[model samples]
Structures are given as C-alpha cells and as structure tokens.
Target: MRTTKHRLAVVTTALLAAVGVVAGPSSGATRPGDPAPPRPVTQNAVSDSFSDTYADPSVIRGKDGWWYTYATSDPLVSGGTPGLMHMARTKDWSSFEYLGTVFSDATRPTWATRTSGLWAPDVRKIGDRYVMYFTVTDSTQHPQGDDSAIGAATAPTPAGPWTATDGPVVPPRAAPGGGWWWTFDPSGFTDVDGQRYLYYGSYFGGIWVTKVADDGLTAVGEPVRVAVDNRYEGAYVVRRDGWYVLMASAANCCAGPSTGYSVFAGRSRSPMGPFVDAEGTSLDTSAVGGTIALTQNGNRFVGVGHHAVVTDSTGADFVVYHGIDRHDPWLAEPFGINRRPMLADRLDWVDGFPRARAGAGPSDTPQPGPTLGSSLGITPEDPAAGGFTGMRVGPRDRLGGATGLVRGTASTRRAAPAGDVHVRLDVRGDKPLRVTLGRAPGVTVTVDPRGRTLGMSTSGAGRPLRDSTALPRTSGWQTLTVRATDGQVRASLSEDDLHDPYAEVTLERDRLRVGSAPVRLSSGGTVVDNVVVTPAAQDARELAPVPQAGALITGEEFDDASTPALTWVRENPQARVEDGQLRWPVEGTDLTGGGNQAGLLLHDAPDDGDWIAQTKVHLDLGSDEIRNYQQAGLVAHATDDDFARLGTVAIWNTRQTEFGREVAAAPDGRTSYGGALVGTAAPTMWLRLAHHRTAEGEHLYRAGTSRDGRTWTWGATWALGAGTEPRIGLYSHGGASPAAVASFDHLRFYRTRWPSDPGAG
Candidate 1:
C-alpha cells in the first residue's frame, strides 16, 4: 500500500508542555544539508497515463504496494472504472490502472455544496480503517462566491467501500467578499505519538491547525490560527529534523492557462505561532508567507498548484501536482476549458527550504523515468504525421492498452496519384498494397508481396516518370524509410541517386496528396500499435547547476547614512536613517501577528547561507520614561515564527527592572516564549548571533553578548529550526510606549564559525 507523507512524517518533540506528548528517536536520517549523493531519480513529470486529464491528485501509497492517487478529477473513461471519488493507481506512478469512484456524489452532506462536489480530499489510515477529510464546495465559484465545508468519511481500505458522515467536521463560516476565506480545504496530520490533528482553511481566514480526535472525526480543542498569505489553500503539514513545516499553494488555482498557482512555506519548532517568511516578517490572518517551492515553468506549462508530497523508500520527497497542458492547454468544445495533467518532480532543499526539481523544473524536456518501474506511459504516436498524409492513427500503446487501427482513402489517377500516400506500417495486408504520392503534381509507389521488383511511377506537373523494375522484396517485414529531401523518391534502399534513364522527373513543391479513394480493411487488418512525429526543434534542454556560491561577508559601519545608503529594507517608510545611525521611531508596532512582539526597526542579512550577524545597540532616551519590554538588540531571525533575540536592555514587564542580554525564540504556532534568560543592567551592549553546522550535519544557533565589545559571554545554544537558510540581522521593539525610537551602530556580518572552527586570520 502507498504510505502517506504527512502521516509517515514523525515530528516529535522530547516533551510537550501542554499535553506531555513524548517524542521517540530514530537513525540513518541524514541532515537536509548533507552533501550526499541522491537516491537516483530517472526523470520528472512521470504521470502521463490516462487518455483524460487528472488534477489535484491526493497521492498516498497503500500497504498493498500500489500507489493510489485519489484526485479531484473526472472519472476514468474505461470499462473497468470504479464510483464517486475518481481513483487511479499503479505499482509505480507510470502505468496507472483506473478504479471507479469510491463513493456516490448523491451522498453529499446537508452542509455540503450541492452539484459542486468535493474540492480537496486527504485520506489516511487510522487503526484498521481509512479516514478521509474532504472539502465540499462548488469549484465553479471557488475563492470567489463559493461556500464550502471540511467533512469526513471512513472506508475499510484505500480502495474504499466508504461511509460518509452525517455532517461537516469544520462547517463553513460566513464568507465576505474580499475578506478572509474561512472555509474548506482540510488536511489530516499524525504526530509521532499517533496524535491526529486536522489543518484546514482557505484564503479568507488563513490556514488553521487544530487537534483532532484519534478517529479523525472530531476536533479536540480550539483551532489555532497558524499561517496566512496570498490566496492560500491546500494546507499540507510535514515534520523534518524536529521542525513542523507548513506548506500551502498561492491562488488563482483554476484559471485555465492563465493560472498562477505556486507553493509558499513557513515553519516553527512547534506546529503552531508566528509563522514568518524569509525576510523576518510574520504571517497572520492577512499577510503572505515566505519562499516558493514550485511555480510556472514557461510557456510550455501553467497552473502548477494544489499539490501533495510522497516519500519513497529512500526518504526523498517527490511532489505530485497538476498543471495545464501547454500543448492543448485549453480543451476544445464539449471537453470543458482546461486539461490539467498530473505531474511529479523531486523536491530539493536549498539553504533551508524546498525547491522543486532542483528549481529548474516544470520542464518540457524528455525527462528520464522515476526508475522505480519499467513502464513509461508517455508514448509516441503510430504512423507518424510525416509518414503519410490523410491517414488517421492513434497514439502508441505498446503495452497492449489499445487496439491498433488505421484508415485512409485513394483517388483514381493516371499520373502521380494523390489522396493516400504511403503508410510505413509493419502490417502487410493479405493482398498487394498500392501507394500514390499524389495526382497532377504527385508521385506513386506500389509493392506486391509475391513480386520481386517494386513498381514506381509519377504523373505530375513535372516530367512524367514511370518504372516497373523487379526489385528484391525482403522477408518478415519491410522497414521503409523515405524522405522527400530534394526531388527524387529517395527510399531507404540505396545511397546512390534515384535516377533512371527511362523514368526522369523532378518535384519543385508539394500540395496535399496521398489518399485518393476510400479503402477498407479486408478482415480487421493489424497495424503498428504506436506511431510518432518528430516535431520541429525545441529549446527543451536541461539546465546545469551552479557549482559553488560566492561567500558573503557584507557589513555596514554606519559612518555616513547618505553615502552607503543603508541596505536594510523598511516595512514602514517612517523608519529612517538619522545622524549617521539607523533609527526606528516606533509609534506602536508589533513584531508578529499573534501580538507577542512589539517594535519596528528590522533589517535583512546578506544571504540565506550560514552567517553571524552582530551589531552595537544604542538607546538615547535622554532620561525620558521607558516602557516595559522596551528593548533593542542584535537579532538573527530565520523566520518571524522562529528566531533568536539578544537585547542590551529589556525592561521586565513583571519585575520592572531593565535586564541586559535578553534572549528568546518566537514559536511559530505556540503561545509560549522560548530561550534561556541571562540577567544584567546596561544602557549599551554588544550582541552577536552565530550559526554553524554540527558534526552529524545539522545546524546550531547561539546568542552571545559583550560589555566592552571585547569581553563576550555566549548564551545557551538552540538547535530546533528545520530550515537552515537564515536571515540574520538586528531588531528593536516598543512595548507599552508606542513612541520609542531604537538605534544601532556598526552592524556587521561574517561567515558563520562553529565551536570547532579555527580562528580567522
């Protein structure tokens, strides 16, 4: 059976403070940054099996060794197709065997969208039964005037004899136009202790993470608002190296060829808090998240969204999603509008996030196979378009998936006969076969199985040429390779010029010819099961990777604000540089969406690579009254949800004392603050945040402080973030008093150094 990527991922913390959930351990798992050789993937975009298109594929492998993909797509067009939910399965992803619907659409719940059916569905096994969470919506009006529900159902196996529940698990809240999308799109996630949590929501209310019953039929507690951003949906959660990663798709989901769907990501040590983006900005019920995974390739592909991930035996994550077919992007009359095909590509980790197909993906090249199986569903057409004119041939199905058939016509002619040209087929009929190049300006060639010489003639606009010379006929099959290169009927028999003294002719141009009269199969005659046409040249070449990246040691001494023009980006234009220093005048600001942080001066590091960002903190309140939690210091923020902090002086909200060397971590999903506390009273302090790789190939982050900018004492180290690529810089916050101004001096960053690294020169 296929394994569920979300369920199979075990993100267990050592101890849960609220529920006391314990995390177990494992081995052989390499760090994401480890430079080990890949497990060997053959190619990308492997799902090209069905005659009809498949979209929004919910991929999970059953324990039965078959990769079952239940999609929000149409039913299979075969005689052996299965019920309501369309399903296609294969041992590998290549040769899919379609099984009919799992349940009837007539069973739509009372709260469900009538006629619209299911939008997003996720199924996972609990105990001996499979529980599926689905979004009941009218897709025709999705993200616009649509109302939907997140519901549940259960089945005995993945193949399903499913029983629908009576009502919606997460009912639809009132949706206002241009407001938070508070409905549908549910995902079932299982933690290390087998605890099940349901994550759901749309662009309206953002994505919410809630603890669900082990049966996955009910919620256990209040849902927590975790992530938000640009038309977000399809909430998928996974755990890697002690971090709960949230992945979602950006909107314009089904806009035919004009769709702009892509994956955005955010992470936290816990499954819940201030989930942020790459630039240290926290996402809330209204903001866009950070980074991109897969996106539009080029003109050849579009609408790359509504995705799901599956891991192989080698622990590699391959994303199975849908995109509009660029060749026939829009469907013709009677076939709707879009042709969304299921595609697969391996996920690559750069810095600290996932990049699809090494980031050069969504390609149109003839990629290799997944190497997990022997069959390739994408086949060339039979009796190619160039083989002859006026003939209709089906696609190649060498695996016996189709019936071989061919048809054409012919016209009576004295000169080069037209209508049906030659059919370079392996099929040799019971009788002699004749082929006419064309009439008037056409040529002709004929062959008899019993005859020795092949007859050839031409009666066209050019000189009439005719020949009936006895030519040897090969046994078994005649492999004919003909090319209209210059003017001669250059058959693949000899290299010499096709010139005869008795028959001399030349063809200057070509017009539609070949079949001149209708022809029928003598007795259900056979032909090649496959045919293909070599298209004109395309720029579908594979791109190479850049070997090494340039090292970054960027710094700003803050000597002249007008000269270097501070490299930091201001989210608030009011924060400006003054008197040779970066000044953030906080009139009332918060660092995250959950309201735990307050302050507004922030900056980004040179790169996402490993680095140590440090700066001198200066506060010139001029004896004015200060607010509690009013702090200024050096910050190393990987994400707004997860980051390290060090303040020269932070007034205690409870003790009412200014403490120096303040440190903490803003959990992505949880409400609790994390980090070791060190006490001190100082107006000005030097701060630094360092990150480096561990012996086992993981990342470690630490915060340190210095009194005279020389004597330093490093704080406790934290190693909980799953993403390694980081944004290290400085930050300041104003709590209680909104009109607080924080300043920084001589901010600089260097390549990260570990406890084991040699000192720099």
Candidate 2:
C-alpha cells in the first residue's frame, strides 16, 4: 500500500524579495495574473468570513445555545497573517461569523516561540471549565528541534479570555530512530463510564489513546496505539449504539488541486480500540482497511477530511469538516495557499456504520443547518434490521453463511419502504439475481454471476440502461446494494463491505418515478438473506464549474533561436534548445536528499498572483527494472534545500509522478526530503505546478500531471518558505543507465482562474 505523507510547515522565511514582472495581454484580453473577483456564498459552502482557511475543524454546542467551531492556525483571508488559533460560532450551523483567534500574541503560551505554530485545537467542556488541547509546533524546552507537544488552555466559556498551562499536557515522544514522533491532532472523548481519554498523533506515529486524569490536564497511563501509522490521522471518536467509532483522515492534505484527503472509519466496543471496519479488517493491519465515511464526490469540494461529528438538539448527527474548493483552490490571491472551507452535512447510520448523507459524500449545494442546543439522545434504528416477508427460511446461519437459501428458480420477496430507498442483501447464486424498485415495471438491476456483469433496466427501455462488466465473481456470498433516489438509480456489488464496492453502476434516467413503488427482489437458485431496505437521503446539489487553465503569460517554445543567455540561467550549459525541443541526456547526478549535482535550466517565475508552470517531457524509464530513481520534469527551485520538484520518475517496478519537497528540518537546519505521489506517469507526460502563496508568504505549489495535455489529474501540494522566490526550472537526473535522453517540447506559464458557474460560459 502507498503510505500517506505528513505535512511539516517550513520555518524559514523567503530569502529574496519578489520582483514583479508584467506580460502584455494577447488580443486585448484580461491580463493573465489578475486576481479574480470575490464570489458570493451561494449553494455549497457553509462558512462566511472564515470560509477559505478553516482547516482541521472541530465543532461543539455551547451554553449560549449557539454552535461553536475551532480550526488550525491560518490567515482567514489573502495577505492576512496567521493567528494562534482560529474560532467561530453560529446560531444555525449553516452560516457562521468569525469570532477571532483564541489567543493574542500577549496571551499565547510563553513557551511557544516566534516560529511555533498552534495547530489542531480540540476543545471540550471538561468539569466546570472548557479546556482546549492544541499541538504546539515548537516549545522553549526543546527549542532546537521540531518537538511538538500537546498544550492545554482553560476558559470559562467557549469564547473566553483563556488561561494556559505552564508546561505541556502531553509532551512529545522521542522517536526510536531520531527526531520525534509527530504528536498532533488531539481529540477528547469521555467513555460512558466517565473515563476521559485523549487521542492524538499523525502519520509519523499512529493515532493513540491515553487515559486522562480527572483534571484533564495530564495523562494517567501509557498511550496505546489505536490506528496504525502511515494510514490514518486526525482521530475523532464517538460512542454510538454500544460501539466506539474511530474516524480518521487519510491521504495527503493540502495538495492544492490534487488533494485526495478523505475520512474513513472503524469501530470497536471500547474507546481503546482494536478497531475494525465493516469488513472485520483491523485498522492497525498492513492492509489498512477503513470504511468510507466521507470522500470527494467530484464536486467543488476535495481534500475533505479531519472532521468532527456533532449531534444537534434534534438528535440528528452531522459531520463538520474542512474541504478545499477545487476551482478556487488557493487561499491567497492568484495562488499560494490552499483555500480550505468548513462544511457540514447530516450524518446517517446505515448498517451499523455512519455515512455522510447516506454515502452521498460532501454536498456542493445548500443543506439544512443543525439545530441549536445539545442532542436529546435520539438513536437511529440500524438499517440492516428491516422487515422482510414471503421468504422461506431454513436453519439460520448468521456467521459467514446463508441466512435464507432460495430453493426455486425465481423467488420474489417484498420489502418495506418506498421513497429514496436503499436495498442491500447478501446473495450467492450460479445464475443471476434481479433487484427491482417501484412497481411491476420499476427499474430492475440484474447481477449476473456467470457473466460477471451488473446491469440496469428501466420501465420503457428496450435494452439495459447501463451495464458494468467489472463485477467480481467469487464463490462466497457477495453483498449487493441498489439505491434509487432523485430520478437516478445506482447499484453496486461488494464483498460484504459496502464502503468499497467492487463493481458499481449509475443507471440512466427513465420515466419511472422513484419513491412511488415498493422494493422487490427475484433470484434463481440464489441464497438471499440479511435483506435491508431503508430510506436513502436525497443529497443531489449544484456543483461548481471545473477549473480551467487561463491565458498564457509566457512560454518557451525551445526553437533554435531560444538561447540560454537572455532569459534562461544555464546551470551546466550542456544542453541546447533545437528543433523546437530542449534535449538533454540523463545524468548520473541528482538534486535529492541534500545532493545538488544535477544540471538545471532555470527561468524567472512570475511573482504576482496564482500561476501555473508546465513542461512536456518524454523520458522513458523502462519498467520492471531497478531504475532506482530516474526523473525529468519541472522544478520550483528556491534553493537545493528548499524546493518543490514534480517529475515523471521510475522507482523500482512502478512508474509514477512524484512531487517531492526538500526543506530545512527544524531544530537544526539539516535538509530533509519527503514526497507525495500524484497521478500515474506515461513516457510522454505533461507536468504542471500550480503556484500560490499564503497570506504569511508561504509558497504552495500543487502538482498536476497529464498523459494527454488536455486532461489532467492534480494531487498533493508541497510548500517552500514564506518569503522564498522560487524559479521555475527543468532538469534530468537520478541514474545514467541505458543512456536514455529526455526531450522537452516546451515550457509554458499560465495565469490561474477561479472557475465561474458552468452556465455562465
């Protein structure tokens, strides 16, 4: 499994001042890097003033009958500076008003230095006062290295004049190798028996839970690891229906447009968990099994994770989380910081697991806000325990066996419920099973075991409306689900784990009206049992327009006349531009891991607004060989120790697009390198870096790659220092082997644009 990457904010400031460059518009069009106008809060987003930069959010109901939320330290708007910790509140959970930071410079912890960052606040009302547990990026006790620890602060009210503890609540743990295990993302939970626990840690150290003293200021016992490392982070625990559910975020957060950060879940009987997902797969195993609680649904929001589950006064649960806007990805004007806004959606318990809006994922349209006040202890019924009739049952076998075996050729069973229904059943058959919604002529979804196909047929359709051939054919009973809502129907077949379906299909819309018919299932010699029919929530919302690369600011065609002297800075002067391409032989040298021996051809990057740097490279690092690491593509060079590189590279048997960041590690200024994988690589691929800067001067470069230039997949971001003015460059290095040459067709730069409504264009 590919391990998730953890983000470490670079402490160094930009060494050089930005030099502004202007490019004339082509044909009197808008200037390439002009900042787009502000957009009004319409359908999807929930936050108001703190819309763009509210990250790692936690929501709670306060005594004032209003909902309060806290987030990691970040500037709320462009050109603003980060505060110690951000806070906000709402009367209705949909719209919010910024309540300012938790601490001013005078009130912040004295042990925290100028460079220390207060992150991932976990605020809870413990005892008589509210205590906030936050990750202190650096402390005066360990001033030299990145020794992050948990710190606590007390306040009489949710928004208050807070008081800090003298020392760390949970000190950082030294790693077995060196440095320290990342002690971050703190969350508080109290067991039903009144035992308090604090859960913290990140990718470096798996999430762990430790008993908290009655005062809630110190740990009472040794921490036990709950979720394994490299897979989960940002742990939040909730007790529901005699089970303790652990929800954690996975994948790279803050990769700009490429961020795949998502939320997943596991449940155990105890808060200190040997937690397992719906498949009974352990969360601590190498397989890293997790049931999807929330993920990007190809809407405006992405990088949706690091959440808090809140229950409203009406007893409805809602998941409050942060999501980055794909179209306006950056928080800073033009480009620089990721614009992560807080979002909330109703949560429903299905099959004993919590799903965001019944597996619809993040909403891009307006949703009803949560009610004020504490929940009144309402527990939803488990959807799996539904009523079914007209089924002949034999001796019951509930453990990995058939509950009801069909004896006849085709047996039809009627199920309860009508509108927006979700029907699931465990079935094993040699022939086929058909699940239909509505009346006799309702939409029918067929699962063909022999042909390994999943197809759907509507009322008046001459043929199947949709057919998917990727169904897994196995001997064991497979779980099949059919969801029909909002004039659309979807069907999926999985190995009992509904979260990760093996094959799924979205059927074409027909004249059949949903919610007007009852559920029916028919199968031939198939074992069908554990049938669940429940109402699936309608969450279809208007999505924002997809982002488009704007007009070109500048480019290098690599023609013969394009020399290295005028605009380019040649590092080794070995390569030349000819035949409309820049050709350079692969070198044995590299610029990775504190080494900077490779040659580079650099060009000045624009200092204004958000922009994209792109290059088309054809470098074939043959597969199945021990290529080690051979790469050629784009680089945003600050210095050898402070750069973000995006390239099509070969590592062992796999070829991938690797976005690597080399930065000065904390404590001492030693260089450390880490990477996040983006899209897969083809021999001829186009690489891009969408560059932006935070209000505090941190440079954010989101990586994008394309096998075909027109279609792109963007992923995770790497950061340079706040003040660093990185030059865009190209290089070929890693290994000399087999004497392959890298050919660069052109290097182009384009202005970034926040997408307008789809109908506007």
Candidate 3:
C-alpha cells in the first residue's frame, strides 16, 4: 500500500479567466514581481516494503555520495533490542541497504542491560571516526523504575564496527517531579564556537542540555533545562544564520496503531535556550510554545516523531524520522516487531520558519545528487545496491514508437541520466527501437542512424523518417546518443558527425516502450550507454539572491523566499516594525478573539474595488479549542466577503474534523491545521493557503503547514468559488479564545496575470 502525507479533500475547479484570460494595466496584473505558484515540495514512500524498527533516524551524505542513516532498533531480538543500535544506507529514498545492528554483540555496559531498549540514536563524524549518541532504558528489569541513560559509541565508518563505552555518559538524574528520572533520547550538535552540546530528556522530565567533553564523550557540566513541561523528546539541533535551533518531538509517541507524535522546534542565541517563537515569546515551561514543525497524515502514515536534523553535502537541512505504516498497522506490534524504516524530507525556510513539503511522505525517488561512477547504473530494477542508480532500460523498456524490445529476456537495464535531467538515444540499427515515453507532449525519442538509410519512427506521432545514405555498422562497440530534451527528441551519433541528423519527433504520449520490430531479428542488438542528459538549470531570474546579514526584513529581495511579503504578514498579522525590532502588536479589537488577521493579499488593483486576486497564508491560531468560524483564512479570488470585507477567509479551526479524529486543541489554547503546535500561546508556525484558477478548474483552494516555516506540510487541497476578478486578505474574528491573541506578519500579495508581450533578447 502506498502512503502520502498530502491528501485531496475537495475537487477544485480552475478558472481560466483568473489565470490570464482577462487583464488590464491598472490591475496589479500578474507580472514578474508576483510570487510564483506553490509546487509539491515532497513526494512519498520511497522505500515502501520494510518494517525495520528504526527510530530517531539521522541521515548524512558520505564522501562516497551515499546517504548513511542510523537509527535505534526495537527492544526485542538480537540487535533490535533497546541497547543495540542499527544502521542502513541508501543512495535513493526508495531502496535501502541494511548494515545490521552496530552494537549488538558488544559488551553490555553497566548502565545498559540486555533488556534495555535503545532509543533515539544520533551519529556524526569527527576527524575520521563516526561518533554516535543514544539513549538506553533498562525497563524490562526495572519495570517500575526509570533507568534511562545517555550512552556513546565510536565507529570507523557510518556502517560501523562500533565500540560502546562501559557506562552511560549522562546518567539518570533525580526528577523534579520526584521519581527516578529517565535520561535518554540524546541529540548532539557542534555550535558555531566549536563546542559540542548534547540535548536530551524524556517524559519523566523536560528536555535538558549539557556540553560534551573535548573527547566528544561524557558531559562537562550539569544538564540545564532548555525545554520543559510538555512531553518533549527527540531533541535535535541545527544552526542557521547565527541562530541555534533545537527541535524536539512532543505528545504521546509509540502508540503503535494509534501513535500521535509530531515535531516542534525553538531557537536561541546559544545551544541552550530560552528558545522563542515567531512572536518573540519564550518557550514557557508551564505552557511551552514549540511550534508544530511537521505532522503525520493518516492516509500516508502516522507517528512522525523521534527525528534528527542533519545537513546534506549541499548544506540543505533535512529531518529524518520514523512513522507507523498506515497500510500495515500490525507492523507496530510486539514493541519492535514491525515499525517501518526511517524516512527523510528536505527542510525549507519560508519567511523565517522551517517548513516541510505539506502532504509529502518518504521520497519515492532518491534526490538527484552526485553519483559514484557513470558506468554503474542507478535504476528501480537494480538489485537493491546501497546507492541509487541514475536510470535503467530493460527488456520491458518502453519508448515512443517501440513497445517491448527485450521481452521475456532474463532481465535488462533501463537507462537514466546522472541527475534529474533529460536525454536522447541514437539508434544505428536498420529498424527503430520500440519504446514509449510519456503522454503526447510528453517524452520525445530521436533516432539518428548517421545517414538516410536508417529508418526512424515514433509511436505517439506514428511518423517515420528514413535516411537515404548508408551508415557504418557497429564493428566492436560504437556509442549512439538518443537525447530526450524537455519531451523533445533529438538524436546524435558521434561528436564529429553533427550534420544530416536522423528524424526529429515530438512525443504525444506519456509512457513509451522500446522493443523489436514486427519481424523477429537477433544480430541487431543496440549497444546503448552513456545516457547523457542535462537537467534544466534554475534560471537566475527564477532564484532570488540570498539576503545579506542584518537585512532586518526577510523576503524583502523576494528571490529564494516562497511566501510573498504580504502573505507573510497575513499569517502573522501582529508582526510589525517597532523601533527597529519586529514586534507583535497588542490587539485592541475583538475581531477574532483579539487575534490580529494580517495577511498577504493579491489584487488586480492597489485600490479595494474592481479587480481579481489571490494570496497565500501561514497561521498560528494559539489554541486548538478555539472554534471561532472567524479564526480562519480568507482568499478573495474574484469576490470579497462582506463580513471581513476580504476576498475569502481561509479560516483555521480547532474544530475542523479535517485535521484528524484527535482533538485539535493543544494543552494551551492554540489550534493547528496540519503540523503540531507546541504551546497554546504564541506558537511559532507557518501556513500556505491560496486561491487560484486553471483551464481545467475554477476557484482553487490550497492549504499547507510547516513548523520550521521553510518546508511545507501539505494539507487538504482543492478549489472553491469563482469570479473574473477577486481581492484577497487575511480574516480573523474577535471572539474565539476568550484570551485569544493571534498575531500575523510578513504579508505578501500578487495578481494572477501572465505577461502579454514577450521580452526582447
């Protein structure tokens, strides 16, 4: 069963008129200045069929280009037991290479007994050796007590020949609440000052922080309370732009079939906090306001917690965590019997918060990156080697014009490019290689036999071209280049023979197969290799420059920032400039329980009347219990609501059954739509809500969420309402939470009008 974090709640209609059909100069027409439409950030279920009880999974790209993922095993079996640690490696998200338990047969330390369940393992490299930190609980023997402790191990490499220490580095401390406290779930990070800090805690107490000794083992000082009060676990940290961010898992986890885990985060000047939210509110130990970073989707899977933050080779941040397979609920039984393997998603920064691709699951395909060698192919059919293959073509290979060439053969390889790219193939045989590409206007196949004597044809187009001149046949091994460029086919033989090319065809179909001709032939096997295709590089015009230091306002340049300037404000209405510092304004009205509804609005005109528009939003409603129909978002595509005098109210409700069967309210009063919110008051958060129209649909409604405010966490998506011109804004009611004080900032808005006249070269 396939799982996805994103699910469609309603079918949306696209209004072509709103897209670009009707337009005027005075109407802030959709132009280069307008924000781009939201695209699907992450896909799901890369490696689907595994039940490895991996938790707190951390992934790092090795020098060899493979992603090394380390996780805590189940509390049962040889290596699956708690004290034991497990490791797996994958080049792509779809397949994994299990390296087995790393510290199973090692001597049992005094702090870790055979029955102790190991939890939350994090790994990092120092010099040449890999350092691992984890939490172990001897709960089986000490069933009535908490014997959880943080431990350390060393390995020559990520796969490991791990050497476990004799005892816990950070022993269980006395609990503030009285019982023998469990001290486990350790996360390690090196601060900008080159000091190593270990962040750990459990339900027995709140999250604590301590510095690591010079040896990278043992604590140098007493554990300090960084995050307290809430059920915070899985402490992970990363530094960006001088700020140290600490992310932790909150709420009841490991409920197996009914797990309710989500991620939350806070940031501070140093590794230890007083971490604050977007509203500049500190994480209250009594009412911690860790904003929801990401959540689990029932359709995709649940229990998205126990994560670790790692920076990829490209310096991109990613969160690796585990989830209960919604399709296989039984996998969560017997403690560590069937928990799924760990998964990863890219973290993005929207405004200033980290956001995961809303509605995304484990990536189905490995991310396009550096590969080992061009000779070794990376494809779905490859025998589950550790790393990902570029692309492969097999007997069942489908291309345009050709159906199935290598059918019934033992097995063949499907050819793909090095990275996310386009390629072309050169067929030098008498007959064309039968293959199918995507639907029409999809993938194009080109055949260049060097001369007119060679015959080429396309399946979707059904057009044939015959070369008149005879071409040289393959003596030993001649290479032919078949290029698929943006769904257009162009064939080239050698670098020198650039002239008199074979036929050029456009693909009309999606899935094209390559196979033999109607007449059976054997000696004419094509030697296909060097599948060369270049990925369309991002245009400079498309990428905004990275903001300078102390720029004060982010998204001001509007290059890399996804949320428009006005949109940022709608989600954070209270955000405003006060004596140089961004401040959340105290509410004077009861419009939405004192919740200020500031948002980005797209309009056809700078004025209020006579125009169409749309906008995106990010909201933090403060309490999940507050159900003010007014505490929602609004997008006036072509029409504005008379109540709020805005286009539409993309209202967010703790009562919306759309989130799940669970109560939307957190301990505090805040309500969350997609991701989990840590506190009830001043929860730092991110949301993306939009209204648009397309040729196939009218009045589209789209929404997503994120904890970090970078990567988007997708939620119910669809289209609603219709009009030629609409004005949009953020809508908040005055009466929701009795003390409800919602704030918004960083707002941006853009009109949906394409440029009519093309620019000159």
How do these models rank on lDDT, best leading? 2, 1, 3
- lDDT values of the candidates? 0.49, 0.67, 0.43
lDDT of 2 by residue, 467-535 (tens): 555553355556676765444567766542213244667754422224333455566556665454544
Candidate 1: where is the Cα deviation over 4 Å? Answer: 1-45, 73-84, 106-113, 138-146, 175-182, 285-287, 334-336, 366-761
Q: In model 3, how large is the Cα lDDT of residue 33? A: 18
Taking all chains together, the TM-score of candidate 3 against the true structure is: 0.47
Model 1 RMSD, rounded to 1 decimal: 25.2
Which candidate has the highest lDDT of all? 2
Where model 2 places Cα greater than 4 Å from the true spot, the runs are 1-43, 333-335, 373-761
The lDDT of model 2 is 0.67
Model 2 residue 312 lDDT score: 44
Off by over 4 Å in 3: 1-43, 47-52, 63-65, 75-83, 139-144, 332-338, 358-679, 682-761
Full candidate order by TM-score, most accurate first: 2, 3, 1
TM-scores for all predictions:
0.44, 0.49, 0.47
